[model samples]
Target: MHDPERFGAAGPAAPTAVAAGCTSTPRRLHHHDQQAYVWSRVHVNPSPSGVPGEAAQSLVPPPRSGAASVVVQDKLYVFGGYGGGTGRLDDFYAFDFRTCSWEEVQVLSEEKPGCRENNGVVVLSARDQSIILFGGYNGHRWLNDLWKFDIATQRWICLEESSPDMVNAMVNEEDETNAAGMGMPQQVVNASTTSQRPSCRFGYVSVVYDNKLVLWGGFDGQRWLNDMYVYDFGSSLWSQVQQCGTLPSIRSCPASAAEGKYLYIQGGYDGLERKEDFFVCSLDTYTWTQMPNLGRTPSPRYFHSCVMHSNKLFMYGGYSGSQRLGDMFAYDFETNHWSEVDCSSGDSPGGRSSLIAQVHENNLYIFAGYNGQTVLNDMYKCRLRPIGIPSPSLLNDFRRLINDPETADVCFLVEGREVHAHKAILAARSQYFRAMLFNGHMRESSDNSPVEIRDVSHPVFCKVLEYLYTDTVCDATLEVGIHLMVASELFMLDRLKSICEDLIRGEISTENVINILVASHQHNALGLKEIALDFILQHLSDAKIQGGLTELKSEPDLLIEILKLSSLQPVTPFARRLGNATQHQVLSPGTEQQPSQAQQVRLFNAHPAPQEQQPLWRVDWR
Candidate 1:
């Protein structure tokens, strides 16, 4: 799938080992009849500009075998490796390409489940990125613990072991949801049964395929293995696929790279023999095919590192029998061939094995590994240049113009609504600055014209835009939501306006009814008041509003304000009935009451009843 000879050593050299720090002497190339592939050497130091040093406190030391590594979001993550005195580590570390540094990441609730080496690690692109680690050998006993690491929330979880009862339960669940409504139990039962399952193996080659992890060739204590198995993450189930067609007879330490639907396996030892032969397996067809012999392949090696970059596969230093090599090789997938490149110019490290190599940003990063006698703790970046160019400037007159007060008054309409162009223009310009910093493309100016406005703009809209850019919620009160709503409305941002409206709607839960009422009235957010009134009327009786009315009556100015809001609104019939009941008061018969109807008739002729009848009516009924 990937070219296997993309970064190898090119020129010919009789087998020789240069001392550490000595420049690799470039040997003259033979004039072959075939076209020559010229390679230029550029030596990169072990410690690049951003890479952390071995002595750095944050730098994680390279662990011995039995480690698990994965790449997520351009960062390489290493977890749970064995170190001599440290035993089995449950710690996690991440290497950032941007920072070129290794930082220790604490895996919350980490438990030293077991010490293991040569474990099978496969990164599953499921549930926010997780690495699944299976079966590894501890010092004495072999392990079958299946642990998963979540990248988003740095944590490790061990999967529960599956049993026959669990399998039966799963099968039963599947049967109820079967297609064709067959309601057949035997079909489900037959599918659950499996034979020739891969014995728990360590140091296996595991790769992701069709959302399943396909594992092949590993050691199982007694012998090296070539058995293949597929683990489905969704089902938490393992099934052994038929090992088809002349598999690489039982082997270990094979390098693997997956491209398209085919997995290419190369160079590993088969107990009695060191092999250089390579094979390709079609995951879709479940068939293995041997690749045609490429002239002058890398010497037979095991435990070498292989990484796919830009469809080209790069192989780095590893052990060939007793010798540890620092040579690099690249393979061309189109021609199914290997080519050696000139990597000696860059500050190449000494020969090593058991190293880890990962590709990021078109560069190969090689971490610490064993250099025959001792374990080394150095990191190197191999810079591969497809082409070169000069860096361009990011800042210019246009950026300064947007920030200047003279030009800041320019108004623009993003979605047919007028807004101050300064903030939006500046934000768009900032992205260009970032691109330039990251060595990305320069920003190009657009021809769109700014919207001209005659009125003084609202400062709140500017504040809201500032919050959007910086994520700074200056005012977390209801006012902020109101301001956001106004800005969204003015800018015609329906989504943003909806979000603000939602927040405004949520404010109805506030305990202070008066504040809610005032905010709702000011913002014309009647929806909020409806919710507030619903709560108030349900929990507080007429006594509460009456008390408020009484207090308002004591203060004339406040009463005027209260009366403004108390005007006729759509109240329920029950509330109107309650108001009528509270308004009428019967007077005591003995107490001196208002003038009789006769006196009102003599004074202003307002009464229709006779004087005698009025006095009788006024008498105490009791």
Candidate 2:
């Protein structure tokens, strides 16, 4: 839940208004003492040396709003926007996450789009690596031009131009403020056009899906629109979509995101009112379904920035009409719930609107926007973390019940030592125990006398009993792990056997690698055997000092494996770079000694190329 005291100026008030070329002094929201923060601002290094870990600062893009930006290959490419005194801008800049630095993208083409703001932009295709632009305000009139910018070529190509009839209609308008109240040179599109493209407009939401641009809802100079359109990139055609179901009301500047087959729309102004209602549209069915106003609903707002990450929809600061809101909220698709993200910690991007927010990897970035007082040049970042309480672990509960005399319905006599155990737990955990205690004609099942286990030692049996109860083994050395692996195989507990194999593999050293290899081969621990072979191959010299070669020489089969593996290892550039020059050397008992044909057949009969298998526990056995 969110803290209400954090929102300043109390109850709803009249919406604030401001003029161009001047700052509107909107006060910052009050800070609260939150338990945990979900958002943290990234402090970039601004030093001339570009050294990291200095005092936190940013060398970023200039302050601007209504910019068109898109992320490609870990780089954020920002295009034109209104840069205050610089008026409308056509300059391009990119912020590289790898270097944590900004660079101006040099345009190679002479033909380019003029200075503009409030344009729609999206990545056309991953294969082509280009940005598609459409419809924006160029300070004087509304634009319906369609352009494409190739990131690799640093070139722009105009695909389509604005209809002259529509341009003339806005130019000859009587009331210049037709788009109304939100600023810029608003004009009504009183005259309709027979053009094959969408009419001149800006502030519409655009999403790329299936190589098509899906655009919905914006001001068309005359009135707020609720129409939907699809532009096919392959065919270069625009078509108005016939939508079904309860459609969203006419609105503009709503925070939106698209994932899979659905597009989500939330909170925007409808000319007369700001909305808090949320809606989703399916690209497949072309249907709009209003999402239930459940959980912690955000206040009515518009011009906010929204992004999708890890199946979550995140929204940041925006104007709530009455005041600018700094609060952030996330809607989870899996749970269908909304939760307020705590940003009270770190440097929060306090209360701003018209900001450009984008997500790359695990970080959410917000660039310049109007903070009421001024257009910000500063940039902020938040490292996204997983939300909700983790499911509780049952390890401790089961551990406490192990060998409890009160709950012991059965007992085991192993190596002349009494180990109390629950029959239900043992039977439920192991197939061997289930058959022995419940199904077979074993004397221990009929009588209440303890079952005699002569094969396993007492300590190994105790560890096995603990694993039956908790499905885990702890504080096990390499010796104990090998015994546990044998016990697991005997009881047919594949998961426990895999865990034991992992324990043995993790404790492998040049001194212990030969021992692990011997145990793995003896117990059919194939994955662990592969890891040991690779370890011995990588550190042959160190292992040889510990009688590693003597042990393998005694076992002719093991010696053949080492020689065959070493002979097969290719000395690639990567291997050479890692200084593994001896990867191709076949170190045998003697210089000329090699495995015979019968020994080669025996080695081939075993698992092929065990070194290729991963060291992790195999899921196939489970």
Candidate 3:
């Protein structure tokens, strides 16, 4: 492992970058030819104070848009962008995640790229330890320059000078290749045979993979672009990439993020209008496939920002056609579903576009954007929760089967309504259905007649079918939970019974504790019964006031158990009197003298007023 101290500098003003140290010994970041063993990936290093953006409030970058951002050595570096009325900015800034502070980068080299916005920036490799920048608008004109900023030397070297006739040269080459080749498009042939640089463009998407920069879709000064190009860092050559499958539309300022061998692009402006389409390009075959728009997709917008973290693409605020948007959405590649994020959980940055976002240690940090009214330099950080393999229903692809009459073979006539269900699914999920339907015991199983369910209501039976098919229930209530618990017991769905038991347990209180205890005992809900019994034992004083003594007395076994359990624990004076009086009437304790009904009334009348007390578990005898 390389020492983090190697990147640290001595001065206060100069950029002091460090590779946030880990608790354990650091491992090789990348596996080269000499590297033999693979190292386990570690979580992103958290701030020393354990609070992100706490120290970043005072020192922040000036408001701007279309800036380029790249994360290196646990630090985020942001370059030039349009600074609203301040014009374009060429200043560079770096935020140290470890220190939670922003520092202006002091360039040692006098020569550097001019002020620009919407540029492409990436880190080619850890060994190079440099930032690669290319192509942007420089206020005066479009630029096609390539510059490398060395982190160790703190200097910028111009690898390729700004080209004035870059577009014309590329056009001439394409024309010649087409004229020489047979009636086929020569773009694909020239892509392999000829080496050429892309014309000057802004708002293009660029990502680094296998040490090569993949550039696609941007706006040249004249028109919107929809071409793909690759820059090999090893050969230092540029080549056009011929793609297959449905191509993404010609657009600019689209949100793009790269993961593994796939590049995901979504929402951009196509000169005519903004688009909300989604597409993915395979880096291996250069194939583009449009993903179906599914579930809570963001509106058509451009100049948005996206970052890939833990197999999910998080897209944040952008410019709609009419105004700026502040919404956040996440797209799951595994399930092909989009979900809106709850931005109200934290300090939201509000509506903005062209912001620079980078993921560090599972936290997404966005900085500098145009919010329609003004450019903003405020930085907002929100920790990202990994979008796991959706819910079980989505994972198993069975949720759609619920209440789908077209595919259902059995219909249950429940409480004056017909509830459709599949016999195969019901039989497979519950033993009650298997015996009643397939064992030749019921007439409804062999015939087309609907099965009559008299005991269960329509809503309750529907919840049962939902669990039978999808393995879960939605929006269960206290009333429904008690009825569902009874239905679950009748249907022999233990998992469903447990789920209902848990639901009813959460609703346990003095008002319903005894009733719940009686229902649990009647329905054989052992878990709920134990919990309810404990509740009554703990709150014996208040439970007595809830007036379930008649129900408690009905279940003589339950009442005796409550009395026996209460005898071993510390009790309030009122509880001791009640238990003793009830025990005398119920058990008739071995001819021992016991308080009569009238005497018990006198005993209660003579006792002191009930004082506020803790629950049985928390009660202190001393």
Candidate 4:
């Protein structure tokens, strides 16, 4: 039950006494059970009488069940519920609270536990966010197994016990030795300790209490249980506690609700009789006490659904006798009473039983259940207004990038345009850009006259225009790496410069070394030159010098430039190597000489090196 005051409902004036022989309610209950009972003052039914009846007539099909369900990061996950003719269901679905929609999620493998029903499922209360599923009826057999589904990885892992045989198998796989060769006894001991696990059980209700899982009553074929078990997730161990006071009789399908430190059980059938009596178990004291006089209590029912939302317990459709119910009600634990709610407007699902209900981001989700005869597949959402901050928009732009990679290029294009314009303006104001354009010319041809100039295109000419108009650099290939690197360096964009450097470095194959050296020289980038020289020196050892010389002889001028730059460096290992090579005249002997008229004429007439070399410089970096 919920606190009435929290929902603006008037509460009971005083705490009512329980029936005789009942112990005092635990102190934690006072926080949720202290308000006045105000059932008569509030209207439970908001809709007209005919609304639910009409909605029932328009019932849509529901997804199959015996499936596992859990919520993480405000999204509802429904995985592998029983389907194939009510036997076993391997289908997976997810509900987005923000969109009020449902989507099927695909698993990596087709292998799944056969059709199952009444399985115990609980979301791990850990930061890694996995959901645990335990024993249930898989059509043919009663399953006593444990499996976990990692929401992020979308994979299922079977949890196995640490037996000697299993330990030995793991050890053999990890170690390359036999029993006599086993390294240390403590190694096996440590392995056993880390592998210790919990026994598997299904059809149980598991709720988080003080961050531990408190598991209660579930059928295990041989018998129904009234026993209670606690699982410490941190320690991976299970312990049973001796609880005092009258406990709820052994039953399955009871709606269990948890708020703060107490677990509430209500409205389950005990094979022979349908029950209306409810009980609250305190985690702090390990005791159970009957809740008194739930005024206007829901009819004797089982397989009904109850979920805690904003401290109020909401009860939805379930079976009663031979009939299915569509009515919805709210139980106020604070006032020790129940009231009906009118769900007339918007959308309302028809009567459903064994349906799954979970709360995510203040919204309640009701998933697949049977309405007496038909299994429902449709999904419904109940919206709850938040208390403090306003609802946040679910459409985050950055998340859109991960979900839809195709849109990334378009998004980057738009953003890049703005960034490029800003960078161009900054480049216009700096000396770095001046150095790149030194002794170069950029002429707009009005007439076919060969233009001669030193550093044409003033920074101011394009700077203001690009800054105001947002001009984007469309050609962002390796060809543009040198230009972009120049601009990036001028604008102090180290990240962009690093990206350009990486692109240039990746293009430094032996065939492209001459082009790379020319670009590095044009931009006056010592870093780019160092990268090219190191690559050539590392790969071009004495064994490969014969093949490298053929390519180098064609670019004698470039080789001369490299030798001149190498000579200016202080004596380091690289300088010593370069000096030795220069002294030996590793390049063509006449490269440093003033050529004769015949050789000069041959150089002027030299066909621009192979087309392969020209296009090699234009390869796309990305």
Q: How high is the lDDT of residue 215 in model 1?
A: 83
Residue-wise C-alpha lDDT for candidate 1, range 476-512, written one tens digit per residue: 5565665565555444445555666677666643234
Q: What is the lDDT of candidate 4?
A: 0.53
Clashes of 3: 0
Top candidate, metric lDDT: 3
Cα lDDT tens digits for candidate 2, 1-622: 1112211233112222221221124565333322234454444444233347565343466667778889999888998886765666777888777766676787897667767777778898789888988887765677777777888898777776655467634464533444232222222222223345677777788888889888888776666778888888777778888999989998888888887889999998777878899999989988999987778989899878899988888999887876778899989888888888988767888888778899988778887776665666566778676344445568887888877778788888988878888888888888788888888645555587888986678998899988888877889977788777777877788998889877876887766677667767766767667878888777654423224444343355775567567556754332232222122233254566554645444443342331332232221121
Using TM-score, rank the candidates from best to worst.
2, 3, 1, 4
Each model's TM-score, in the order given? 0.49, 0.53, 0.51, 0.46
Indicate whether candidate 3 or candidate 4 has the larger lDDT: 3
Candidate 1: regions farther than 4 A off: 1-57, 62-66, 82-89, 110-113, 160-197, 388-622
488: Cα error in model 3, Å? 48
Tens digits of per-residue lDDT for model 3 on 533-569?
Answer: 8887777766343245433334656645766788877
Candidate 1 local distance difference test against the native: 0.55
- What TM-score does prediction 3 earn? 0.51
